[model samples]
Target: MQTNVYNIAFAESTKQVYLHFWGCNIKCKGCVCQKVVYDFMLDRNMHLHLAEPRGLAAAPERFMAFNDVIDTLVGLEAKWVLFEGQEASLDPQMPFIAEALHRHLGTTNVLLTNAFVMPDLRHFDKVAVGLKAFNENLHREYTGESNRTILENFPRIFHSGVPMMAETVLIPGYIDYQEIEQIAKFIASVDKNIRYQIDAYFKAGNNPWRRPTADEVDRAVEAASKHLNNVYAYKGSEPREFGVKSIFPTEAELDAAELAPAVESRHLVYA
Candidate 1:
């Protein structure tokens, strides 16, 4: 089977590679991925433009056989692989894909999802679920979906023995400190040991929300820590620095990279 994987990169923290699958079931209002993915799609050469200056490297969007993906990861010496982007569970063959990664390469798999449609997490080593809000109405307003299924799936995944973590964007006044406190309390009620990370929401594209101040972020983390044993916050605007190498000589070279034709195509899955 072939998948519309548009991007791939390595994460230093996890010492793993990520394959960004194309599709998401929810429309989160302030998602920055829209700018990242579409910018590249509009000008297949854009990733190269950004990659060169930042010393970041990535491959163009393409379709690859499942076995080919496993081989590539093996070549990269990838021990962990994160399946994300728009909601990886939307891929019908995800379970099979996860199994293949493990069976062939002994690579551990992790999934980043909205948790709307629960998947069999038996093969996954970890799962990070984005909880938009603890209040149902706010969740529906922000993500255009109810939080019922997402919240229910959290405990299920945690109880399944696969590690689980919950993350929410600190969207300034919108999903602010009050909301995080409630979210932390809710997670604590289920299992205090579950990891929680508050991601900083930064202005991107036409998103109106402003990024939280360092002081605000610190307070949010402190509040969440009260309810859970392990709590962290990701200040996206200030990502931990890392070194990367280019696989292509230039934008033209990147744009010229060979891409296998997709046997099946899906619609744009996210904003």
Candidate 2:
């Protein structure tokens, strides 16, 4: 089966390579990736603003073949491979990708997902479920999709007996300390010892939420630690100064590169 891979990059902080696939089911209001991907596909000038709703009709460049991606990861001596996406589970060959990363490269495969659809957990070495918000109303508001399926899939993932971790972006008022605490409590229900990483939300696109201050991150972690045993928070940049490469253009590259020529049609667009 063919995989619709759009980009591949390595994260120095985790020493893991990321395989960026093309689609996502949920459209989070504050998503940074949507802006970046749309800019790469539509706005040739590489403006940081959102593409015209219609301009999203342009097809993304298929940067590399699946096997090429595998070969690249192996050459990098990558021990860990992350399946990232607008939603990785949406990829038809997702399980195959995880299996390939493990069977062919001996890499620890981790899927970073919203967990709306629970796949065979046995295919992965680790799973990081992004619990956007525990409150259903807030969840729907933030992600533009109901959290029912996601919440239901949580136990299924936990019971699969695969190693699991939870992550939630700490958007000051919307996804605040109380929200993290509530999310931590829910995770603690499944496993008190599961590591809960409360990440400070970064300002992306036109998101109105402010980036969390160091003290805010500390408070959120402290509050979450009340229920979760392994509570951690990351407030600063990942050691991105260490060289990391991507098949797609970064913000800087987009600004420097000439705008792409107009296209007549596209098979898909960000709906």
Candidate 3:
């Protein structure tokens, strides 16, 4: 049970986990995955490509034997393992990694994939696919390709009996009601039970998308509400921003007192 070294997704509030593998097919234009790009550039001994592929560099650095990885998970007593990545299904070793982790953690396994590769769910406990931008052309424009595979794999995996969810980057103008509706339709086709999430893309540091507005987010959520039973908007601050307390709840605790429920405030605009 060998495992590949990867950056753990250290969300301020979430479950204990590790991003198992590396490399991605999509070089999203405004990617938050810049670390992988930098790592790939360093690993391949290549320079930065801020061009079409944007920050997508390939550095397939693997580490930690499978057994060792399992031992570590057991040692940490991590009840759950999340196989996360730009598109984890693209990693061939995913099934093996999942199997090994399943045996040890016996925890719910969640995969965050763009669905670049059709996954073999024989080992997965839960799967989350990025529906990305709602608009087909818009999605391709940002992520470098159309989400045909992700779209195609929807019902296939849903019917496979794994707990699944569909998510999107709520980029207004990029992801409008039409787009959200399309995403909802796709998820409903798979399983009406699958949850949906809209991650608000705000400017991070000096990153270009740092200040995406809340109106657009509202539109996306409004649209998705028609189709998805559950939806959460990421990046919007709780209480202060008037967002749901459980909007982006911590993995360990569903109800953390610090993150109070929002009061439904005004949509924020980026400067």
Candidate 4:
């Protein structure tokens, strides 16, 4: 009776395989994968919601059994099966899911999450905690929830003795120079077992906002440099990697047209 919510991915960039869980604890507003969980609003036009899995389509089934999910991975015969995406800890399913995949495939499990909910430490090998922002207001404004939950849970999340990769997405104007400085110092104050990741934002996905200037991203990076070690920006996404897809007509695209973005139009159709 394990949850059948996670997926196996083969990344073209790194030739790496990933096992990501669906659903999330915090709703980083305008998120792309709207079909996956309840934290954010869904955009049906851009992303589809199917009743079952068929190829790369997003499946509607929220829970995936570990044994059956493992069968998918072993069949693919991938090198490293990373436990990634959405938020892996929304249910007790992850620890058991991780255990099943690791025991059978003997592949590495890497988690990329907001750290709002920490999994049992004994489950995985490596962890990547999306350390959203150092300040509470900015974090909530950007991701739609206070940083308090994450701040409280992060310490115990690392009890696994596994190295953690700390990530921070630098959105335009949201994460200012002062905030970046605070973020760096905060990361440094926490156990130094973490690596700092500064990622950039774009008009795509579920992200809705103005694009920050290149200079601003640079300044934030500079401010962060003073407080911690090993900082790097998440390279911007390609304009439209066809297979990469879009959730809604991007904000810029929405403004450019006199018409409604697909989300509104589609809702009108079925309403």
Predicted model with the maximum lDDT: 2
Give the worst 10-residue stretch by lDDT in candidate 2. 41-50
Sorted on TM-score, best first, the list reads: 2, 1, 4, 3
lDDT (Cα, tens digit) per residue for candidate 1, span 99-159? 8778877888989888898887868999998888999999999889999998898888888
lDDT of 4 by residue, 1-271 (tens): 6764533445433435555566677767534454232211112232322122121213334446666676766665645656665777675777776777677777677777778766675666777787777778877876888998787767666655777877776666666567767877877777643677776654433433545566777777778787777776654432323222111223344234324344422321111
The TM-score of candidate 4 is 0.71
TM-scores of the models, in the order given: 0.80, 0.81, 0.70, 0.71
- The list of candidate 4 runs beyond 4 A from truth reads 2-7, 12-15, 34-63, 204-208, 237-271
Please list all clashing residue pairs in model 4, or write none if there are none: 3-64, 4-63, 4-64, 4-65, 5-64, 19-82, 30-206, 199-234
How large is the C-alpha RMSD of every model relative to the true structure? Answer: 6.6, 5.3, 11.7, 8.5
lDDT by candidate, in order shown:
0.71, 0.73, 0.58, 0.58
Better of 1 and 4 by TM-score: 1
Residue 106, candidate 3: C-alpha displacement in angstroms = 1.4
* Per-residue lDDT of model 2, residues 13-92, tens digit only: 55667777777888887775633553322223223332333233333565556677777777777788877867778877
User: Which candidate, 1 or 3, has the higher lDDT?
Assistant: 1
- What is residue 139's positional error in candidate 1, in angstroms? 0.7
Model 1 TM: 0.80
- Candidate 3 per-residue C-alpha lDDT over 168-196 given as tens digits, one digit per residue, 9 for 90 to 100: 76655555557777888778766666888
Looking at candidate 4, the ten consecutive residues that score lowest on lDDT are 48-57
The TM-score measured for candidate 3 stands at: 0.70
